[model samples]
Structures are given as structure tokens and as C-alpha cells.
Target chain A: MREQFDIPEGVIYLDGNSLGAPPKHVAERVQEVVKHQWGNRLIRSWSEGWWEAPQRIGDRIGRLIGAAPGQVVVGDSTSVNVYKALMGAVKGTERTEIVCDESTFPTDGYIAQSVGELTGLKVRAARPSSLDLTEDTAVVLLNHVDYRTGALHDMKALTEQAHDVGTQVVWDLCHSAGVYPTQLDEIGVDYAVGCTYKFLNGGPGSPAFIYVPKHKQATFENPLSGWNGHRAPFAMEASYEPDPGIARARVGTPDILSMLALDAALDVWDGVDMKAHWARGMTLTSLFRSYIEQMTSLEVITPNTLPRGHQISVRCENPAGVMAELIARGVIGDHRPPDILRFGIAPLYIGEQEVKRAAEILAEIVN
Target chain B: MREQFDIPEGVIYLDGNSLGAPPKHVAERVQEVVKHQWGNRLIRSWSEGWWEAPQRIGDRIGRLIGAAPGQVVVGDSTSVNVYKALMGAVKGTERTEIVCDESTFPTDGYIAQSVGELTGLKVRAARPSSLDLTEDTAVVLLNHVDYRTGALHDMKALTEQAHDVGTQVVWDLCHSAGVYPTQLDEIGVDYAVGCTYKFLNGGPGSPAFIYVPKHKQATFENPLSGWNGHRAPFAMEASYEPDPGIARARVGTPDILSMLALDAALDVWDGVDMKAHWARGMTLTSLFRSYIEQMTSLEVITPNTLPRGHQISVRCENPAGVMAELIARGVIGDHRPPDILRFGIAPLYIGEQEVKRAAEILAEIVN
Candidate 1:
């Protein structure tokens, strides 16, 4: 698995939570797409395979996230998809309020705020546990794992709460998607959006995917109704008629070059067991966290619980400076503002030795 | 310039207006980006160059489109950008109507309808020339070149008319950009959105760009305000405070691989004169249209007058069949509904010989 990635020599990269390391074959796949498909085949390539890539690659992502076929489609940035899910969720309902996790990745909260203004719904921010999921709460946007603290949330429990109050839930899976298995279908979640670049390792800023289950497809009123979502897109009709399936959530032309790269990246998950991989992630994080606690005086912010996410964060003095010093010594991690350092544990390529090496470097920097 | 592209040996691809051919060097550039920048550099790639790519590549695209630096930023799909331009242009106004070109590419009309529904404004579809620009019109969305008919519109006159009514104007340059020069800055165009894949020679479905001029930057209110548009995006602030420049038009993480591919593709424009290239386009279109008329009974729909776009549409019986036969004979052109067969003459890589040869093949297919 380590040989599958092209991690640089002596560079212990712990920033997979920000941007994942690329698979070695992605370079070749991208070249083939650029030269053979796009360059040689040209427009005919769209019909050849490019036209349905959003749904095709989306289903591949669906396999990892516990979604069956025809429920997810990929394109657009996470911010745009967040806007789509929130706006599409509340289209026909009489709900007057949108609740969002106060600690969500800032983009989700920002888009929810804009959707609130557009739909004339009041926006409220609260912790995931304390969300006041009344009948008037149109939707609640939650991050599966906190970006800054790497804190995992109870998706099944919170979703049941929202459903009990007759409200909807939209999950931001940016930090959680490929790290562990999520039962999106079993829970019957209303909408889910996640980035492919993080733990999914789909290169930088690859397009995000949105899940609109089969039951919800018929009435999903996409606000950004581009022609790609139109039933007969090639007919080029003046009026907008959305496709009857999950593709109705699609907006605009699929970013082919980026999308196919993600398709290639998903090949890594074909034979790996997500549950076992998640257990390995726990082992690596526990090893790294225990080393830090014993060797340094930093306060580990990530909770020491049974079901934590793939990363660990610690509060320290002058985190930016400490991160730079660590990076200077070939330990690559990132610092959030104010004073926290985050280290992502990607189980596919990262292992026990790399974790101990990174912890040793961190201990050296602090001492 | 034709040698700079990897056009297949026998295929006379006349669909560059739909999807441009890839440049010869884009394959190598994309490989380097995917392998070295993303694979080895990891998260450090953002600060190295990815953080500013939207604006950096935007300036390069600006040179070809007659926009000065700092007025253009690139990301997202053209449909998404159209929504942004329309919504951002209509904010802080008392006008109650948005007039869109009646025959726009369907996505533009669809997005305008969605924006109309969201903003509580009346969306009226009218021809570019016959638009009744009244004081109540907030903005008029016009296509610089008609996608189906290849008829070019008067940007200067229509923009003046809209200004006369104290209304803003948003231009969809999907068909016109990179084929000719658009005086967006000189015309004081309010806002513009255009795709990069066509004549700009970005890869298929590369991210589109939006131009918000310096004067309008302060008041531009982006409806899909995401964290990327935040004043301090890295600060991870909860509130959305738009960057006080063209970047306010950006949403979400920059699609790095696709955008950098576009950046590499723009290198083809380095030594080319856009005005001279547009003249050559007129020449090629004229030759193709004349040859078709001389040898076949096809009724050409593109005007025979000056200032036409790069495409020439002809009405033929069984257009789908005719286009298929033409493609089978190595002459690649596309067809629209009922009877329109569209041939796009890209001046950058296409020339007199390919146009004449394509016309000869078309004559054989029809006769």
C-alpha cells in the first residue's frame, strides 16, 4: 500500500486530512485521459464514456460510503453541492428555519447562511447534540467529523432525532468519507455531500459528490438547475426539465480531467476492507496520541473515545511556528489558527513507524 | 499552431466550438502537476502555487479576452458562474425584471429562471436585438454569439441600451470568447461568464471563469457566497466576508488539476493575435459555407455578413443521419434538432485546407 503512493523520501506527511497523497497510477491515468481520450478522441469521447462519468464515478464512491447504485452523482465543488443539497431539501416544504452545526467546515455554514437568506428561512447555529430539531427546522447541516478538532459525530443518532422532529439532515463528509464506513442508506439520510480529495485521495480540489436517494429524486428541486440535469440534455430545449434520477442534482458540465482522476483514485478502495482500515486508523492515531501525551506537554484536543475520526489535533503555543519547524524536519502537518496542530492518519499508506517518527519529531520540536 | 495540437490524423474535427482539441503539451503539464506537485508536495502545493491559481490563470485568460488584470477569476462551471453573475449583478437594485436572450444555450435560460425564482424578479426571455430594456429591468443576460445559429450579437449597443435604462448587463461568452476579442472593459460590461474548453483550448469541461470589473467589485453581492470568497479564507472564519475584488466571484476550493490544465492550455495564446485569428476564422467559415452551398442543396443559416462567429450552421434533411455519415467519413461536425448541422471553425488550429476537405466530404454525404 505504501508503494502505491508517491510520498516523497523522508517526508512524513500527516496532512491527508487537508489534501491526500496521490496514488502513483493517477499520473498515468490522467495522461491517458488527456492524450488518448481528450486529445485523440475529442468530442466523440463524451459519448464514449465522459458523458456519464459523474454518475459512474459517483457510484464507485457510493460503494465506500454505504450507498447503493443511482443515489449519488459527482460534479461541482463542495460549496456548490452544499448549496444544492440545502436548497433542494427545502424547496416544497413549509419549514421556516435551517439549523447548522456551529463547528462545521466554514463553507457549509456559509452556504447555509446564503440559502437561509435566499429562501427567507432563519438560520441558527448550534452544536450537533444541542440542535433544536423542531418541526420548523427545515434541515440540519452537520459535519461527520469536525475539521479543526477531528471530533466524530453520531450520524445515526442525530439523523433519527431530525427525523423524529420531521426535519431533514445534510451531512458534510469532507473529513470522514473514506476513513470509515457510513451507513447513509440504512439511516435513510436526506442528503450528503463530501469531497473526494481528502481521505479519498482524489488529488487536489477534485469535484465533490452529492447523494439524493432514489425516493427523494423525484421531488429534489435543484436550485442551480443547469442543462446537465435536464432530461434530454442534447435536445437543447428552452425549458428546464430535470432528469428523474439522481442526476437531477447535477449542475453544469462535468469537469472531465479532474473527474476521471477521481475515478482512477477510487481504484484503491476496490479490494480494501473499510472496517479493517478504520480499525488500523484507530491503532495509528492511538499510538501517535499516546506518544505525544507521554513525551510532550501539549493538550490533545481530539477526544479519546471509541469512534474518533482519522486525525488527531493538539493545542500548543505558537502552532504556526511549531508546524513550520516540524515541516523543516520533514514532518508535514498543518496548524489551525489560534493554537492547534492537526495530523491526519490515512490507513492505506501510513503505518505505525511513520506515526512514531512523526511523534518523535513533534516531541523534539516542543522540547 | 495546428502542429501544436494532437488532432487525429484523418479526423477533420469541426466541433471545436463544442469542445476544443487538447494542446500537445497539456498532457505533459498535467502529468507533472499530478505527479510532482500533488503527489510529492502534498498539502504544501497550496501555498506554492495552487492557492492563487484562479487569479493567476485568470490574468492569462484576461489578456486574450480584453480584460485587464484583477477583473477576472476562474473556477466552477459556466452554468454556476452564470448564476453568480446574474445574482451578483441584481443585488442592491430595485429593478424587478431579468431579461435573458430567448435562444440562449438552455443552461443559461434555466439558471436565469432559477435566479428569477430565487430573487423574486420576473424573468423575461427576449431576442438580443428586440429586448425592451425598461427602467424596471435589473439585468439583461445576453449571449455574445448565438450557440445554435452562430449569429453574433452587438455587445456595445446592447450594453449601452441597458445602461440607458439604468440596468446592468451580463454576457455569456461561451461561444464567442477566444474566437474573437471582446471589449468587456472598454464596453464597461457589468459582469461576464464564459467557459474555457472551447476556443480557449482548455481540456473538456475545464472550470469556467467570471469577470467582475474593479468598479463593481465593492458592491458585487454573490448569492452563493462560500468560504473561498471570504476575506481571509485561511483564517477559517465562520462569517462570510467576501474578498474585495474579482475573487469574490469565486466559490469553494479551486479545482487544481483542471485549472492548472487550463493554465497550461492558455500558453497556446501567447504569440497569437486575436484580431488576426478572428479574421482567419471568418475566412475559414466563409470557405466552408461557400463550398457547401456550391456543391450541396443545404440552406446555410449563419449570416453571410461580416462579424459572424466561428461556427456556420446549415439546415439539412435528416441532420442526425447526415452528421453521422459525415463523421463516419472523417468529417466531424455536430447537429442540433430538426435540421441544423453545425460546423465550428476554430482559427487557432484549423485552416483553409481542412475546411475545403470537410466541405467536399459533406457534399458526398448529402448528394
Candidate 2:
């Protein structure tokens, strides 16, 4: 698994949460797609393979997230997927409010606001721990892991509470999907969306995936209603009739080149145990946190009492300048503006020694 | 310029109008982007080059389409762009109808129907030649070339007619952009959108481009309001304040791999003249039509009295079988159901010899 990625020599990359390192086979795979499928086959490739890319690649992603075969399909960006899932959840409900949190990813909040404006619903933002899940709430948007603090939420517990109050839930898995084990179906989650560029190791701007439960497929109407979602996309129909299954979530022509890269990237996860992978991530994050706290006075924001996702965050003065110096010293972690410096522990390529060295370098910079 | 593409040997590819052959350099360019920019540079590539891709590549395309600098930006699919442009046009208008034609591409009509349903407007479909442009028409959606018939419309005349009746126009330039010299700015077109896979020779399912005139940028709002279009996208603002320029039309993380291919593909047009390219297209299309007419009894649906686009369509019995036979004989053209055989004449890689051979093959199959 460690040999599956192409991380550069002499650089410790702890930003897999931002952009995953490319899989080792991606360069050769992309060349074949461009030179053979596109160059030789031309338009015939649509029927040959390109047309089925979104759903086929999506099913592979489904396996990692515990979704059924027909429950997840990949297309569009995560922002667009959030809008689709939010709209699909609230379409015919009598409820008048969309509930999200201030700690959610900013794009998710922005999408909620835009969808609320379009559907004439009130968008209410509350603290994550203090959300009042009520009957009037049409949808609750929750992040599986907070992007800035790496704080993991209790997804099953929150979902059960929302269900008790008769409200649907839409989860943003951008920070949790590939590295964390998500039992979406077993947990009875209604809708989930995640980007592939992060821990999934898809290249920059690869298409995002959305998960809808089996029962909700028939009623899911993606508001972006492009032709790809039509019942007979090639039939040249004048009216729009959405496809019946997860394919209905598709909004436009598949970006075949990027989709194919993601398909190849999924090969690295062939037979690994996700539970074991999650254990490794926890061990690595816990080790990094303790090493840093013992060496420096920086405030670690990640909560240690609860199990979290694959990253650790710290607050230091002049965080941006500190991160620049760390990168110059070959320790590559990213800084979110204002005060936070974040490091991701990708279980696939990152190991214990790399985490130890990264912590040592961070202490040297801050002190 | 024909030497620049990687069309297969012994195959006369007349389907560039459907999917353009990959430029010879695209394979190398895609590998560099995946391996170095994405794999080596990691997250830094977003700020280094990916941030400006949509606008920078758009300017290159603008040079070919006669659009001024900062007038075009590329992202999303053609279907998505159509939805964005149509929604942006009718946002504040008092009129309540979207006028299109029955002969327009089916996706454009479907998008119009969807937008109308969302915005409470009636989508009226009339014949292209007899479109009733009145005060009730909020926006007119017109295709520059009929997808099935290869019939080119008089853009300047139709635009002036729409403006005379006080309605704005949105043009679908999918079939006419790279091969035809479109004066979008000169014609005062309000909005335009097109795909890059055809005459632009971007790879399969590459991101599409949208053009908004300089004067219309401030007021335009893409209904798919993703954070990428925010005024300061990295600011992570919760409220949606659109970017003040053509960037407002963008709506998500761009597919950098495909976008970079399109960026390199646009380099093929650096020193070429579009007017000269359009002239060559007319010559090849006219020759193919004459050769087919002299040898076969198929009914040519393309009109000779009017200047048409980069292809010719012929009506024959069992078009699917005819196209199969033609492809078996190494002359590749696509079939649009019911009864049409369509052959594309891309001036970049297609020339007189390929056109003559394709016509002879079609004649032999249909005679």
C-alpha cells in the first residue's frame, strides 16, 4: 500500500486532506486514456466505455463507503452535489427550515444558503453540539469531520436524533470518506457527498460522489436537471424525465478523462481492511499530537477524548509564516488562515517515522 | 495543421464534429500535469496554475471566437453551461417566456423546459424560421448549427430580430465555434456557450466554456452558485457574493487535467486565421456533398442555397446499417437515428482527400 503512491523523495506530505498524492499508476493510465480511448476510438468511445464511467466508477467508491451497488454515483463537484442532496431532501416536505452548523465547510454553508433562497426556506446555523433537531427542519447538513479542527462528530448518534425529530440528514464526507470507515447504509444515513481529490487519491478536480439510500432513489430529483439525468439521454426527448435509480443524481455529461483517472486510483484499495486502516490513522494522529504537545507550547485543537478523523491541527502565532518555514525544511503540511496549521495522516503512504520527523520539525519551527 | 492530430491510419474520420481527435501533444501534456503539477507540486499547483486555468484557457479560446479578453471562462459541461446562461439571462426580466425552436439540439430544449419550470416561465417551441419573438419572450435560445441537419442559421439576422423586439439572445455555439469564425462580441450576443471536444480538439468530456459580454458581467448570476464563483473564493464566506467579472459564471473546482489539455489544445490555433479555417471547411463540405450527389440517390438534407456548417447530412433508409458498412470500410461517420447519416468536416485535421474518400464510401454503401 505504501508503494501505491508517487510522493516525491525527501518530502513529508501531510496534506492528503487537501490534495491526495497521485497514485503510482496514474501517469501511465492517463496517457492510455488520452492516446488510445480518445485518440484512436474517437466518438465511438462513448458507447464503448465513456457513457458508463460515472456509475461504474461510482460503484467502486461505493464499496469503500458501505453503500449498495445502485446507491452511489459520481459526477459534478462537491458544491453542486451538496446543492443537489439538499434540494432532493427538501423538495416536497412541509418543513420550512434547513439546519446546518457554523463549523461546517464554508462551501457547504454557502450551498445551503443558495438552496434555501431558491426554495424559500429559512437557513438556520447553530453550533454543531447544540443543534436543535426539530420537526420543522427539512434537512440537517452535518460534516463527518470538521475541516479546520479535525474534530470528528458522532454521525450515527446525530442521525438517530434527526430521525427521532422527523428530519432528514445530508452528510458532507469530504474529510472522512476514503481514510475513515463510513457505514452509511448500516447507519441509515439518507444522503452523503464527498470529493475524490483528497484521501481517495484522485487527481486535482476529479468528479465528486453522492450517496442516496435505496428507498430514496425514486423520489430524488436533482434540481440541476441536465440531459445526462434524463431517462433516455440519447433519445433526444424534449421533456425531462429523470432516470429511476442513483443515475438520476447525475447532472451532465461525464468528465470521462478525470473519471477514468479516479477509476484507476481506486485500484490501490483492492482488498485492504478499512477497519485496520482506520486504526492505523488513529495511532498516527495520536502519536503526532503527543509528540508536538511535549515539545512546544502550541495549542492542539483536535479533541483527544473522542476518536477523530485522520488529521491533527495546532494553533500558533504567525501560522502562515511558520508553515512556509516548515515546507522549506521538507515538512509539508498546510495552514488554514488566521491561526491553524494542519497535518493529515494518510494511512496508505504515511507511516510512524514520517509522523515522528514531522512533529520534531514543527517543534523546532515554533520554539 | 492536419499533422497536429493523432487520427488513426487508414481511417477517414468524419466525426470530428462529434469528438475531435486528440492533439498529438495532449498525451504528453496530460502526463506532465498529472505527474509533476499534481503529483509532485501537490496542493501548491492550485495556487500556482490551477486557479487561473478557466480564465487563461478561456482567453485563448476567445482569440479564436472573436471574444475580447476576460469575456470567456471554461468549466463544467455544455449542458451545465446552457442551464447557467439561460438562468442568468431571465433572472430579472419581466417577461415570462423562453422561446426556442423544435430543431434545436434536444438538450438545449430540455434545459429550457427545466429552467422554465423552475422560474415559472412558459417554454415555447416554434420553428426556427418562424420564431415569434414578441414582448412576451424573455430570452431566445438558438443553436448556431442544427445538430442533425448541419444547417447553419444566420446569427446576425436572428440576433437583430430578437433585439428589435426587445428580447435578449443566448446562442448555443456547440457546432460552430472553432471551425466557424463567430463574431460574438461584434454581434452583441448577450451570452454564448459551447463544448471543447469538437472543433477545439479537447479530449473526451473536457470542460465546456461560457462567454459573457463585458457589459453583462456585473449583473450575471449563475444559478448554480458554487463557492468557486464567490468574489473571494478562498475567503470561505458564508454568503454568496459573485465575482465581479466573467469568473461569476464559474461554479466549482475546475477539472485541472482536462482543462490543461484544453489549454494545450488551444495552442494549435496560435498563428492561424479563423476566417481561412472557415473557408476551408466550406470547401470540404461542398466537395463531399457534390461527390455524394453525383454517385448516390440519398436525399441530402443540408441546404445548398444557404451557407452551412462543417458537416453534411444525408437521409437514407436504415441509416444505422449504412453507417456500420461505411465504418467497416474505414470511412467513419455517425448516425443520428430515424434516417440521418452525419459526416463532420473539421478543417484542422480533415482535408480534400479524406472528404472524397468518405463520400465514395457512403455512395458505395447507399447505392
Q: Which candidate number has the best TM-score?
A: 1
User: Measured against the native two-chain assembly using Cα atoms, what DockQ does each of the candidate structures obtain, in the order listed?
Assistant: 0.88, 0.74
lDDT of 2 by residue, A292-341 (tens): 98988889998885668899999988888999999999988888767899
Calculate each model's fnat, 2 decimals: 0.87, 0.70
- Candidate 1, residues B193-281, lDDT tens digits: the string is 99999988899999999999999999988888988898999898888999998888889998899999999999999988889989989
Model 2: lDDT equals 0.88
TM-score (0 to 1) for chain A, all models?
A: 0.99, 0.98
Off by over 4 Å in 1: none
Q: Candidate 2, residue A68: CA error in Å?
A: 0.7
Q: Please state the error at residue B89 of candidate 1 in Å.
A: 2.0
Model 2 chain B worst lDDT run, 10 consecutive residues: B299-308
For model 1, how does the per-residue alpha-carbon lDDT over A86-142 read when each residue is reduced to its tens digit?
A: 998888779899999999889998899899887889999999979978999999999
DockQ, model 1, C-alpha based: 0.88
- C-alpha lDDT (0 to 100) for residue A239 of candidate 2: 82
TM-score for all models, in order of appearance: 0.99, 0.98
lDDT by residue (tens digit), candidate 2, B164-206: 9989899889899787889999999999999998888887888
